[model samples]
Target: MLSNTTPSGRDVLLPMFFIGLMFFILGFVTWLNGSLIPFLKIVCELSNFQALWVAFAFYIAYTVMALPSAAILARTGYKRGMTIALGVMAMGALLFIPAARTGLYPIFLIALFTLASGMTLMQTAINPYIVCIGPRESAALRISIMGLFNKGAGIVVPLVFTALILSGMEHVSEASLGALDAAAREAMRNDLSQRLVFPYAVMAGALLLFMGLIHVSSLREPVLDAADAPADAAPRQGLLQHPQLVLGAITLFGYVGVEVIAGDTIALYGHQLGVAHYGVLTSYTMGFMVLGYALGVLLIPRWLSQRAALAWSAGSGLLFALGVALGSSGESTWSQALLGWAGVPAVPDTVLCLALLGLSNALVWPAVWPLALEGLGKHTAAGSALLIMAISGGALLPMLYGHLADVSGPQRAYWVLLPWYALILFYALAGSRLRRWSVA
Candidate 1:
């Protein structure tokens, strides 16, 4: 549990704004993978499974380095820890320059891993810091406010990045490349690869600027006290004794896996569904997420508890998945109506359901963080690291989805999301309430 002594609204206003900026940065860099997947597939000539390594390399860093990130935060505190994380991300961004120059897929993967390592550290520091700064009950609201910035960046980055590097990419498929001579193919790949250099250099510069700002800012470090320890538990029990934390970690894993599938895979799904302007369609998925986060910020802790919000979000996900699977075969009047309303000529029902998944996913993270970390007290940092590690779902599950897409069709591969959402719904309804471990 967090301290009861809530700071005045004015005291935290600036820090919260800065923290939101960090979330924005996190979203901007992280969600670029959506566009990068198809971009790299074209530039590097990758198969479906090979292109999905973009997500695997990016998200697996959380599993690999989250505990180390916790250790780094323990030593440096949140203020300095965030600064270090930003500096590390800047370095990772700089690596893109050479990776783009070489056009090597492995080097690009390395850069993504390095960048995600920094994001893992940044998340490990900021999530708990946000919860500790304010009343615990309102943690979801604060996180939702930050998420607006986060998903807002998600909405923008793909559009801007695709415009910059992937204009006319729909025409650059394997069939077209095969029609070209060897030198022409190399020239095309090299041209596509070079487009990434200037944008990433600008990213490197922006990250360094934010690093300097965070270093000089006076963000307070949270102090854990003896009161945070469980009253009935032994003096030094391990985290495994806490059933809620353990279950919550699994819940988070499922949530992230499904969320990544919804957001990152939308463009690819659109492509498979034969949507011509799939990049533009993908942005709508994130736009719906931003709207949902805005709603969360308004309603959480005021009209709805975080747990209730999570339950509703999970239920919505289940419903959406059912709709996607059952309604995808042929378009109904509703799909046509929706497309007409949006002034688009046609959209497959599956694509619309995938976009609406943004609404289902928007509240899960904010809700899950508070539920998972609640009552961990002194173990909060470690518990947070564990939850962050579960973000490996984003890495592994997408690859699984890709493989399934190759085996079956892309539309049917979404069956994989149904089971993950069922698990999250279980967590929202019961698993989050199973807090058997004492936190005195």
Candidate 2:
């Protein structure tokens, strides 16, 4: 709902570049939870159900705070909204210091929630801001470039955590886990907690500094003349009427669920499957994500349409899930290299499955957004906020995944994606056809 006061210019790329950098940071910070879930679960001695609250607290903030974010944008406009969001994010990062010091699981979840609330606001401002900065036809490519930065951070943050947390110590056996004498365990816990102190402190300082930089930057506001506004102002209509848009939202929701499941769950899932070190899969999965985005940046609109891209992506997901599940259940060499290890391969095969999942995920998000908001002019921002609310799937679906992991084990829990993927495939093939229904 934020409006800009300045004219669009030829050099929009620089500002978009900086914006992409901030998004990269956001993605880095956001996806690090994938690593933290398993790490903190071990350090905090959590049950599968309890540990997954890491995602629940973080992503549910979007459902809670997105409307408020829309309200803030309407008031402060985009530039000031971003500044406020960065400042709040800095405060959230600082909370991690104390949360780490206490080694209390709930406090860490609270800190993550606080942090995610800030991201919710930032995402609300950022995604549309990127779109309005350029021509709509090329939006996916630009967003894909920005996504490269985002998923690129997802690759890096886990590597950093691995070096700092996992690799630095000896691999603790399940037999020895949570069995330390009280004083030793407490000391180990405190030491482990303090590791977060410096990283988060540095992040807080960076966010504050970024806030100042954005305040001083030469970013231009979008110049929307009256001619560009929506053609219609009808107040109440069914989203079902806008089937493509509805389908787009559904696609986005399902895409986020599977992507989070693939990324965040990989570490825990790997551990359960007897992969001794799961940190390595974090970077590998994100590498596939980056590759997918890079491919999208190249192929979309030029060689392929967004709808076509989404369909292929969904199909890849279905195939990859089937390969992983079937391979795990059977004992073929392909299954060993692709799903498990030894003569059976664990890390490599699981990584391959996750990587393939990432590839399938790459196009769904970038393509879905623009297609969803295609014709809704004034309602565009509201519709965007609604889709942003749907990102709450990042929170809820993962909990369901964690519960499934708890009940039937990680590999079996992957059955969760079947329904999610089916919905998306339906949207891509049929839901996009709803554009014919809109008369306005």
Candidate 3:
């Protein structure tokens, strides 16, 4: 029941540019958790398990708010919804002012939750809007183009943030901190906490500015042609009856889990492996993701189908995981060489795997979304919300990885990504085609 009406070139071009900007904003704010995980661990004096609450509090908002976000979007439409979302995010950004002043870890988590709630609404609006704006067959290509904006911000935010706050942090450690007197420890915590204030204040102001811009922008809502309406009037089944959607939701869950682990945990993993510039190395992961997005923009739909892209991404991820495991055991010279060539010569082999994992993750989101929502018609909004909810995998899986790092070693903790990628492979191969529910 999806609208088959193709947008004019101008119609697509103008909205895509603004939507791409929105995506860039999402990536800049979302991926900062990569730097923040290590930053908060030091500032708040947290265990590995405890620090991952950064991801938990941020992503859990999606699971809790996605349905409500969809309902809000249904009433408000995309432009108004986006304006509201941006305003909400600006408020969340302002919460950091109090959080930094108080230096309370829980307050920081609350601020993240508030920020993610706004992002949840924004995503719920923009994703389906993008799909309806173009040909269904080329949805992957369009989304991949947006991925470029997203990952471009991903690449820059971490580098700039690391330079701003995490510089000269190589000498700070739990042992070194324990050796410091109470006054010195308190002074260090205050300094670390205050480092985030200016950056977040800038973020708040920019978000507010964007809210005003979107409020006045002339973006149009998608217009569904009459011919695209469902032919039958039979009662539709619940969303659970669509097997492809259910499986696709699970695929997104696993995809986001591994992607979050690769991006967010790599710094901590590299630090544990004695890598001095691990903060900068985190940008390398986003860089590879940008490369993969570029490739997806080039190859998807024109040369390879979205399904084929997913297959290749999953296979590459599996191979990378194998390399990481083998390199951990010192069984792969090639893996060691790859890590050395990546310029983190002192980093563990597993950190290299984490960076490369970004390549395998790059196309999954673009591919999975179109495949999942292919025939939902009027149900598209509800389906999109479900997919967004699956992003809570970002919340849960990294916390599990953190706990595993605490119990085992960071090198061995990467074993978690293997099963996640394997499940994604299954979805690429067969699960996406399992549409039991009729579109009518």
Model 3 residue 415 lDDT score? 84
Off by over 4 Å in 3: 1-5, 225-237, 329-346, 437-440
Flag the better candidate by lDDT, 2 or 3.
3
TM-scores for candidates 1 onward, in order: 0.94, 0.90, 0.93
lDDT of 2 by residue, 307-348 (tens): 888788888899887766555432334535544543433454
Give per-residue lDDT, candidate 2, residue 191.
Answer: 79
Comparing 1 with 3 on lDDT, the higher-scoring candidate is: 3
Instruction: Report the lDDT of model 1 for residue 352.
Output: 82
Tell me which of candidates 2 and 3 scores higher on TM-score.
3
Clashes of each: 3, 6, 0
Tell me the tens digit of each residue's lDDT in model 1 across 85-116: 99999989999999999999999999999999
Candidate 2's TM-score reads 0.90
lDDT of 3 by residue, 322-383 (tens): 76665763333544576567654545556677789999999999999999987776577788
- Candidate 1: worst 10 consecutive residues by lDDT? 227-236
Any idea what lDDT model 3 has? 0.85
Measured over all alpha carbons after superposition, the RMSD of each candidate to the real structure, in angstroms, is 3.0, 3.8, 3.1
